[model samples]
Target: MATVTKPEGTIATTRKAEAEGDQLVTMRGIDWQGYLTILDMKTDRRFPRVVFLDGEVSFMSPSPTHEFLNDRLRSFLRAVLSGLGIPFLPLGSTTFRREERRGGVEGGQTYYLVNRGHVRDKKRIDLSVDPPPDLAVEIVVTHPADDTLEVYRRLRVPEVWVCTETELVFLVLDRNGHYARTDSSVALPGISAAEIHSWITRGGYDDEGAWDHDLRRWIAEVLSPRLRETTR
Candidate 1:
């Protein structure tokens, strides 16, 4: 049973399963942010061991904060995605459930990689999947690594937003595997990144009720009038 604190950014875990080797999936413990999974690039998705969170034990689940934040972001994104005619799954913590999603599964567990087989740089990450997410959101709280932005770039998540207690910064993954801020949201059209960032940093960060209501209201206001009709 081995565990490590959540890293702010992506940290290479020492453990890497051999090619075509059998991976022993075990659940030892759970971290607040979530856990990771290490998958064999070859075959047998079930065998790629899942570390952190219930550690070899599948009964237990993530903590309250993890569950709540996951739900909140997913719920919001699900709505926005639909409005923009984008297809996506919540895949918050469950993103680690799949073998290919277990890039950093062993040692550094809080953050999980999107796709495993197509890895470009060991130190610099460039994650890719057959069907990549249009966007991803991470509620950045407290963690070790000072550079959390690297994960989004490495994962090649297309567009990402990191919501801290203070602000929400949006980054768009480009052709060169770097991120840049944009006025319009690639995933959520009509959703202003600057306004959302400002709202997240305000005094209402702690109160979920107030924060959500305000966010929804803002979304409704900015979206096409036809959407408001359906939302109502």
Candidate 2:
């Protein structure tokens, strides 16, 4: 396979376009090692997420709306987990790479549940030695060249939630090591993708703080029985 690496500082040049909307750049021939080098270079700046699959690399700079939904959904997920009394560790946009699989990805919000406590204190995750997150959240106002679902599949991610302005796509990895679109999350039982969409895209909230307050109230009353009992 050909190896092509993007020169440093390319991401900095896209600020103008990023100001208008999301900017995406896809490059080919970058090996796994090259991906790691670029990742280290941008360790401190994580806005433009980098994805690596085989020799293809994609850098995605999310738009303001994308960021808004990303953060909103992230906060909502945490509220749901906490209300349900489930322990979780939020690893937002953490680059997870495995050279052996020649796959790497950074979700808008990624999280570990079953193994959250195990790696709670660690600062970095080595997928070669550590377990991958149970679920990854991807917000797609625009799509990219490389298939993120394919990347997640190759990385053996258990579940992925792909959200758009109009739709929420739920995917679960099957026993065959492939992702299949589903109606509900297998990782987050009783939570359908549509339900999450309804909550996230609810209208008439004057501000995010108000929305969050209403969301938490709804989650307590309608989503979690234990939370409802405690509140009552």
Candidate 3:
């Protein structure tokens, strides 16, 4: 299992499958350059995001339901960050690859919290030079062949949120450099995965405006004081 330490690049595991929509194709023995070519050709940037791992490649197309849930979750997180005065840089569906790890992943939504200050003025992210996003999100309307969490773990992302229609799971990277299921986020304190799941499930927002209003209000009236007292 060769892991990319600096994003140099491809792998050799192969699996194939077909579907009515959002097709998935996995194969091994693909060099880093081959994977790069495949990625370069896709201009539309539609569904079926790609993942590359040690000698294997996976192409996945997410469904509309997946997109809807992904959008809602992304918005919810940004609102929370803004309301709480937590600086963050949202990296939406950015393709991240590292040749050294022999794996790469494009998160449904990714964010740089600890490194937000560094990327504030940048026009784009250069993973070779910069740390990977602290948090990556996945909405599992359809499952992929390669393990998503494993890919992130190779990328060294601090946190991952895996959301199914029924449940949301948080995986935090431990000191030993592996993911462990946790109730609360290590990357974003004062918020738990269950709480987020509940809010999305409740779904009272008439529109984005309403969602923002309510989220900010909740933070200001409820979470703020709690966080302040805890810090004191």
Candidate 4:
């Protein structure tokens, strides 16, 4: 269930469930300046990830399970990319925003793959002049009332991987600038969403090191040859 409140003349909605353990709060009528102020205040503490779409802002506090899933997925991605000999730059939970587009979001785990070299040497990313990450990940334990996909669309991110408790979904930005569900990852060629989901489920209860070793083994013995053939 969700609770709606009016604070300081702004309409705010908060959602919390004991089973989910994730909390989401949404506030309406927040101007760009207000959003920036809130972001600045929370700069030191990265929890309660923030997103702004138009005049509405959402703050999400992820749970232990959510973060565990996020960490495992990130490790899996890194292992796959390293096994494939792909050069990638990992930028974890960086805030991406553009005022002109009136949208912004803090990614859970983002990576620059094909466009790795574009912002490789930069200390910071200015969306005004920089290309958005090639791959962005989102772990959604609780359904967001805000339109997060719209913010990603405005940022022109090439690909997004959304993970829920049950499944992982791959969304690729198409020619028409809309995200379409895809069977395989555009950023990491030959990787399928269903395969990734299976790996996550398999590794969920195992020892971390042992699970990772098995994942690497699969990549080396099974995925590596397939990728090599595609390149050739």
TM-score of each: 0.47, 0.85, 0.83, 0.89
Give the candidate order by descending lDDT: 4, 2, 3, 1
Among the numbered candidates, top TM-score falls to 4
Clashes of each: 10, 1, 21, 0
The C-alpha RMSD in Å for every predicted model, in order, reads 12.4, 5.2, 5.0, 4.4
Clashes of 3: 21
lDDT of 1 at 82: 58
Better of 3 and 4 by TM-score: 4
Better of 1 and 2 by lDDT: 2
What is the C-alpha lDDT profile of model 4 across 1-232, one tens digit per residue? 2223233666555444445667777778777777888887785667888898877788888898888889889999999988888899999989999999999998888999877788998988998888999999988886552377889899999899999889999999999999999888888868778889888767455579989889999999999998889879
Compared with the true structure, all predictions reach lDDT values of: 0.44, 0.78, 0.77, 0.84
Residue 219 CA displacement from its true place in model 1, Å: 4.1
The alpha-carbon lDDT assigned to residue 99 of candidate 4 equals 95
Off by over 4 Å in 4: 1-19, 203-206
Candidate 3 displacement at residue 192 in angstroms: 1.9
lDDT of 2 by residue, 14-111 (tens): 21224356788777666666787777777556867888776777888888888878887888898888888888888888878788888888877889
